[model samples]
Target: MFRSNSTTDCVQHITTSVELTPIRNYISELNLVHHSKRVFKLKLNFPKFIVICNNNGARLLELQSKVEENWIDLQCRVRGYGIGVWLGLTDLQREGQYVTMSDACRPRYSNWMRGEPNNGNGNEHCAMYWITRSGWNDTVCKGKINFVSTFKDAMIFCNNLGAELLELQSKAEENWVDLQCRIRGYSYGVWLGLSDVRTEGQFVSLSDARKPRGNFRNWAKGEPSNGGNSEHCVIYWTTRIGWNDARCTDKFNVACKKQKEIAYD
Candidate 1:
């Protein structure tokens, strides 16, 4: 009887293992599908605004009826690129709500706090700048100055800052700066914004006196060595060096600058 029981247990173990094989394979396939789905969502759901500030500020702005459920899908168009106090304040203002001037983009500010307000209290009136649900965040500051508030009560804030804002706006529209992808065997670089040069060493000059030539030189040093009889240049932005060059056909991240008009329909 003992020998018979031992034989029975061995057969059961083999049967269980075989049964689990298909289940395991199914799980692996499911994970792949889940990952692909996530990438699809990201590509489809690109944030309109490159930057957001005051996590609480973002949350308060989202509370608007038009934004109640689909706030993340709303692309964020701010006054500037990257995260900074200017970008943060511009983001909040662009939302068209009353914001504490102090809440403007301070790098040290908390993202978590920005999203959720009054962690310390239940009754504090949230400071915000109000704008129509359909209005663009920058529109308030763009023309006619519809609402009035102070960045600080005692200090004077100038609208000339808006000129700088306009410059950033133009840069974004031009799409001249693009990011390049890493190549298989080469150090990462970007494509300059030029094409069809007559000479191998030719480079483009900046139209604006303040703008730097040679593809974000301060950011990408020792780049654009005019690699081996290459005559064309493409503009690109790099995380490590700001901007630099590679061969025209090389793939990289692109910064396309265009004024995106927000239409609430």
Candidate 2:
């Protein structure tokens, strides 16, 4: 984009620039500058605008939607400054019970940077972007810095330390899991722990290799259709009762459950 000699053309350019549909587009258009004579500088004059975080995760998705090389370029653009700053609000503070997002959403989707939501200060309730790595982190909701706020992750761990895919034994568990999925901002698919590696269409638990209870079959319409007969893994989704039959190698948000073991000795 460049400035033209004609005044009429400049009017069109400026109008198009500020007409971005999403707020993220606005941020990108503004081009925050940390040093002198670079780009548009941020001013804290607006006190009447509303703050929202529920949509932060969506921007992250858009950022990752770009090609890897392009993503690197965007990262540099944001990282021109030093530390992570607010991009949006998050609900990581509830510790599994709840999430407080910048906006109200039934189920939140989270794309936490690696090992994040580590519960910083136990008071970190908002989302921040780590400019250096272009990863997301949870920060104090009311911290000094302002404004701002996953793509599906690749599977690095082949095994879950002998743990099986999560098997929901009750309605409450299923609802809770679904809620968590939404809160994390997942709308399409989320990988579950059920697979048919052993017995072709029959799904079994990765832990005990037992067939799941027959009553609670959550299959999306025409699902488990195994379109090409190659989908052996399952992914739970809130939109569909029947989880999606996906390829095991596909990247997705994985679900892990921790159980306390009682010592008899």
Candidate 3:
């Protein structure tokens, strides 16, 4: 098992992996890597930025407290400064009600600059951290912005590796996921790619928006109650030994699968 505390080993792994690009400033405390700028050339509008990060197994950086804020600031001073980086915060749903994208959690601590979040031009809906000032600012969501990303969340954990959340298309695939988890001694269930977020009770694959083929579903008995309509995402329930609807925001291990290229005869 890779221990996050083993900085030397972590750095070695990151250095050797062509897929990994360590986030420049704050790489020590968090084992995060910035996705390739080549994917979007370092400039993307807020929504696209979120999508890009998600596609690459990452989430936009979130600052939980002043201590974390200071760590980033100090690292920026040590490395160098850029224009700024987008945060995982937005008020798109309701003005003056900024929320984190991962869980819709309201920030318990904030370091907004004085007179900030003024909703400038009545369109600044996304939040960013200015490297030079070390303060937060709300900005226009339409404008392209460079950003720092974190390999947080199950969706991101898989996407970061050029793969996607597992889709159990058959009993064989489902059994494989279960056997792997059991062999590895996973204490909890793994996330599945299916979800009904866009339309209630209509589960679709997150990677490609494909519906399940030919009525193949292994839902656990009494599952998918859509409890409070909050449980939109699906997980392979380890305890129940079948699939169940779950809160999308909650963290879990993920089984990622990438299609293999088949050679033509």
Candidate 4:
């Protein structure tokens, strides 16, 4: 059973290396550093810099959407620095198979410069923000560059623990989970494994890619409106009986599930 005295606990199994303060605003503070010439001269490689970010309770930034790009541009304007910055994207695992360092998931959105990501010299595996071109460019991982940082999300945290968001397949299972939460005094909403991320209006289980059995739906009244056209993820809105569509990025309680072990006779 999962238990947390805190106001938020994405999942019981997923524990963070560093304590993170609960976000009070939709957008947490973005840390985009444009270090001094002396620091830039250090020429630290990608691996070394990633360690620094982790040690400081941060991660190499991942630009998942244009909103983040615009956010970076806004920061650049305020700071008056437009040099390239290191992004958390890389094809180190496999050529042309870029994945974000924050979650090892393929970026849902990318802004590659025209003819960019050419994997120049066969060594350009890391990605960087091309401020001049207003897009991304693959570059050498050994190159010295500035970087950005942001906190990780619940899904990533759960994945790190070898579990996935909870998926309710039957009314009995849903009732059991709800009962457990009530018994544990958990009152906040919790993230579920259901989502329509791949196709609008087509919900599926993240664990098995299956639809709800019997087409069971417990959506709250007038729910799943996909408010702002961004609510693709589903969550238990304060209780098990009521579900709501929400932004995948939004922070909420998480309930993860792991398959039970089966023993051969």
**lDDT per model vs. reference:** 0.25, 0.44, 0.61, 0.60
Tens digits of per-residue lDDT, candidate 2, 45-68, equal 111111221223222222222243
Worst 10 residues of 1 by lDDT: 25-34
lDDT of 1 by residue, 30-55 (tens): 00001111111111110221112222
Residue 34 displacement (Å), model 4? 44
Over 4 Å off in model 4, which ranges?
1-54, 57-152, 261-265
Query: After superposing candidate 3, which stretches have Cα over 4 Å from the reference?
Result: 1-152, 260-265
What's every prediction's RMSD, in angstroms? 22.0, 18.1, 18.1, 19.7
Q: Which ten residues in a row have the lowest lDDT in candidate 4?
A: 23-32
> How many residue pairs clash in all the candidates, one count each?
42, 24, 3, 1
* Residue pairs whose backbone atoms clash in candidate 3: 57-156, 57-159, 57-160
lDDT of 3 by residue, 154-255 (tens): 566556556666777788767766765554334346777788889999999886787875557999999889988799988887767898888876545445
* Strongest candidate by lDDT: 3
What is the overall TM-score of model 4 with all chains considered together?
Answer: 0.41
Could you tell me which 10 consecutive residues in candidate 2 have the lowest summed lDDT?
6-15
